[model samples]
Structure formats: structure tokens, C-alpha cells
Target: MRNNAPSKHVRIVLADDHDLVRSGIKALLSMIEGVEVIAEARDGNELIALVDDLDPDIVMTDISMPGMDGIAAIAEIHARKPGTRMLVLSMYDTVDFVKRAVASGACGYLMKDAPPFELEQAVRSVMATGSYFSPAIAQRLLQPSEPTVDDELTNRQVEILKLIAQGRASKEIAYQLGLSPKTVDVHRARIMERLRLNDIASLTLYAVRKGLIKP
Candidate 1:
């Protein structure tokens, strides 16, 4: 039993490499009242261009694409249009992938195989509440997590730690992750403080022990 209001128009731009996948998703979206499939893109680069041109209300996208990838595109789109809601429609559900997508500014994460009903629910939820995550994803995100002893680092901090362990300088890491150099440095300092490690050498050794990086 449910009570609902009349649906307002929701313009969506979909991006995926596969034609079949995009067609199926577009068909599903079409069934949901008030949802319009305004544009389609085959890759991140094309998606960025479409988003820049159409300015859709939501961007439903996949994680892996031929050129530029969805995470990088989502980051760029979010930077330019913070008002646009990003909903990731991908098959990857690993913690790393989920964390990276979220860090890159996707407010919603729904698996491609999710029940068709869940798709409608996700769309309505994001439009109403400003965010949505599949039950499994939300569970994984809420679960306790830590890569090292001492204290827990945030997903962003752990991401930075791995890069630092790989000997990536702050500027380079910042560029790759779409963050400022100062933000990377701040995360580095916090990671070291939380782990009680004083130097890059120790941090790198810890990362290796934690299997964050290969020796």
C-alpha cells in the first residue's frame, strides 16, 4: 500500500557502451511516469559533452566505458554542475568501486541487474530525498571498515593512502582524483596521524602489510 503525488518531469541522460543495455534501460525508464530519456552517450567523453549541452536533471551511467570512464566523467560533471544528480547504473559493486563512484560525486548507486521496480524506486527516491543507494550497497557502505590498526580512515583517506604508498606525489594524486593538492596533503597528514606513522617510508610499509599496494 502506498500514497503518492503526481510525478514531476525528470529529464535523464543515460550513458553506457552497450547499445542493448542502453536500449533496455531507456525502455524501462520510459515506463516510469514523468521520466524522459533526453539523451544517450556511449562513453564518458560523449556523456560529458551531452551533459554540457542538455543539462539534464539526472545522469544515469555505467562505470566502465571505452574512453575516459564513468568515474572521471562524473567527477568532471559534478565539478561543473553540482546541481545535477548523478545516479550510477553499473554492475560493479565492490567496495573500492562504490567508494570511488561516491567520492567522484555520484549521489545514487544502483546495480544494472537490480529489479525493475527498484529502478523506479531509486529514481523516485533520489528525486525526493536527493540520494539513493541499493540496499546491498547501503549495507556495505554502513559496515565497519579499516585497513590498518590504530584508527579508521575514511574511504577517501584510504584511497589517498594507496596512492601515497605507490609513491604518487600530492599533485599527481590530486589530479587523478580530481582534488586540490592541498586536499591531498591534508588527507596524507590525517592518514599518518590516524595510523601513528611519521614518515612516508613507514606509511608505505604499512600499506604493503595491509595489502593496499604491492611490494
Candidate 2:
């Protein structure tokens, strides 16, 4: 992974749906030493595609992108390229999102509204340690209980969701449980429907709330 400029090089990929968000991040990253934006994606699918093409060392992604979503993006990228480091920056403050992002292989999770210095420090922390969570995210993760809609899902549904939070693909989850993929998907759909979670990010949030995973 190589940044765009030769003089300063820390290749980075930016993935978010909003044009303005991408533009703003790109501007900020350009000023950082040894951190450069090599590629950008407007959605999850595009993010995946860009990784295949550009192979950036670090991926700064939003949690709720269209097409595939950030959690899925993290899992996919990790499964395919375990060496690449990931950082999730999102607006949602839910513990579930933070836990799932780290579980899916994102080394850092920061809220989109974090101070620029916090964001920069997070990136640097992950670059140095291979993992980091903001103090807010860390506190939420350490707490034992947080209000969530998990009561809507049955115990079985909770188990299935735990696997998902662990970055298990539907196929792998089915295989592990000895259930048909379709059946697994049905449970998954039910879990999502009950929790009002439309994407992996939300699902992760749900699992985190239930202590199925950690941030």
C-alpha cells in the first residue's frame, strides 16, 4: 500500500457513501505525515473493489455504507486480506457497532464526530498496536449492560447473531450449526427484522448489547 504522493507514503483507503464526507476526510488525511489517501469508495461494494485494485494498507470506512455496509466490508476485507488494517469511523455511538467492528477485524473504531485529533490519534494507535477503541467506545464496551432491542429476538436468534458478530458468513454459520443455509438466512432475517437492524452494523450493535461480542 502506497499513498498517492511519493514523498509522504502511508497508503490509505477511504470508504463512505457521502461525497462531502469523503472530500472532508481526504482533505484531512492529506495533511498527515506518512498517511495518504490512495483510493476512495462511495459504498461498500466500491470499497471492496478498490481494495482489490489498490490494496491500501489502511482502510478508513464508515459503519453504514450502502451496498454491503462497513461491518461486512471489514469481515470481507479481513477474510481476504488479513494483513490489511481497518478503522471504522461512524456517527452511531452504540456499543454494538464498536464491538462488531473490532471483531470483524477493524483495529480502530471512532465516532464520526470525534475531534480531529482523536481521529488522528486513533489511526496512529491502530497503526502502532494493531488495535484501538476510543475512550467512549472502550467505556461502553467495559460496561456490563446497555439498553438494546435484543429482547425481540429469541435465544436461538441470539446465538445466530453472535456468530454474525464474530464475522461468520451465512454459509459458514450454517455449516457450523448444521442447518441449511436457507434456514440460517431465515433466522438471520428474523433477527434483523425483530431488532430493526437492516445491516451488519446494526446487527453487530445488537450482539454487542447482548454481550455476544466485545468492542
Candidate 3:
């Protein structure tokens, strides 16, 4: 008997709040062979629902949106659908956004202004391996930076910090990380104390400085 197994095409759910942006990206992806836009979402919440319902191979999303922005959605999707890969397509090219996207479990990041070929390449690389950061992003990540208070945080603390910086409430972080709400609060307090930061605004700025989240 001959073994016959069909290869899977890359199925992507593209999310961007702007209809024109989504349409343009959809058009680009349509031009690439073996790639399919399985669905489209205007916000992170809708993206999550579509991912749960469709189980696409990749989720291509923008970083900023009206509700449940991309970083939070990336974290949630990573937790809920471990097998689904995330590709961030955004206009922001700062190191802060790149680091936060990676930390939040995005498998790839590409600038919106990149050539269409680069977009196709990023999707292929992510699906083939486990991750792909565009050339510009890779170069930025390689740049040296001064150490800061974030260097003092434990890995778990950093995890919680990124979510907090993304504006997730303690209760929401608790649910996402499978920890108690009180535990999340404790971590938040500890994070504040370690960095000598008194308010969420301060912590958010610290996160940006440390390349933990977008400014």
C-alpha cells in the first residue's frame, strides 16, 4: 500500500481594525501561493473567537486596536491555542513593540510597509520553523542596551509585567495565567517595589524602557 497524506496549506486569520488595511493585506496574501486568508477580524476579541472557531494555522494581527489590543490577544491566543502561531503585522517598528510581541508569544513580526514578498517570506518561515522576525526587527533586537530594573525581575514577574503593561487588570491576568487574583496582585506589588515604581503609569513607562511592552 502507498502512503498518501496531503500537505496542509497555511491558513491565516488576519486582524486589523481598519477595513482598508485588512483588505490590502488580504490582497497581498491572496497573491502568495499556498497561503489562504481563512478569516478576518476587526479586533482582538473577534480574533480570539475566530481562532477558537476556525483553528487556523496562523493569526496575522496588528498591534493596536480599539478593544483587547494585539499584545493581550497574543497572550490569550498563545495560552488557549498553543499550536496556533501568531504573526504581528504593524506599522510600529520600535524595539519595545518587537520585544513585547515576542514575549506575548507572537511567532513572527513584520512591518506593514515591508514589501509584499517579505510578508510572504515571514509567514512561510514562521510556519516552517517556530518563529520569524523581519530583518529590521532582528537587527534592532541585536542592538545593545543598558541594563535596567527589569533585569532584577524573575521570569514569572516579567511575564506578569508584560500583561500588566498591556493594561490587563489583575483579575484578567490571574485568569490568563491560571493564578489566583490575589497572587497576581502580590506579583504586581512586588514588581512595583522592585522597580521603585508607585503607579501603573510608572510601571508602564518602565516596561517600555526595558523593552517589555510598546510605548
Tens-digit lDDT string for candidate 3 (105-212) = 898999999988888788777877878898998998898744433357887898788889899998999999999999999999998998889999988888776655
- Top candidate (TM-score): 3
Residue pairs whose backbone atoms clash in candidate 3: none
With candidate 2 superimposed using the best TM-score fit, by how many Å does residue 52's alpha carbon deviate from the native?
Answer: 1.4
Q: Where's the lowest-lDDT run of ten residues in candidate 1?
A: 143-152
The local lDDT score (0 to 100) that residue 102 gets in candidate 2 is 76
Give one clash count per candidate, in the order shown. Answer: 0, 2, 0
TM-score of 2: 0.68
Error of 3 at 161 (Å): 12
User: TM-scores of the models, in the given order?
Assistant: 0.67, 0.68, 0.69
lDDT of 3: 0.85
Candidate 2 clashing pairs, residues 3+ apart or interchain: 96-205, 99-215
CA error at residue 122 for candidate 3, angstroms: 0.8
* Candidate 3 segments whose C-alpha is farther than 4 A from its true place: 1-7, 145-215
Candidate models: Cα lDDT each: 0.85, 0.78, 0.85
Give me the runs in candidate 2 sitting further than 4 Å from their true place.
Answer: 1-8, 146-215
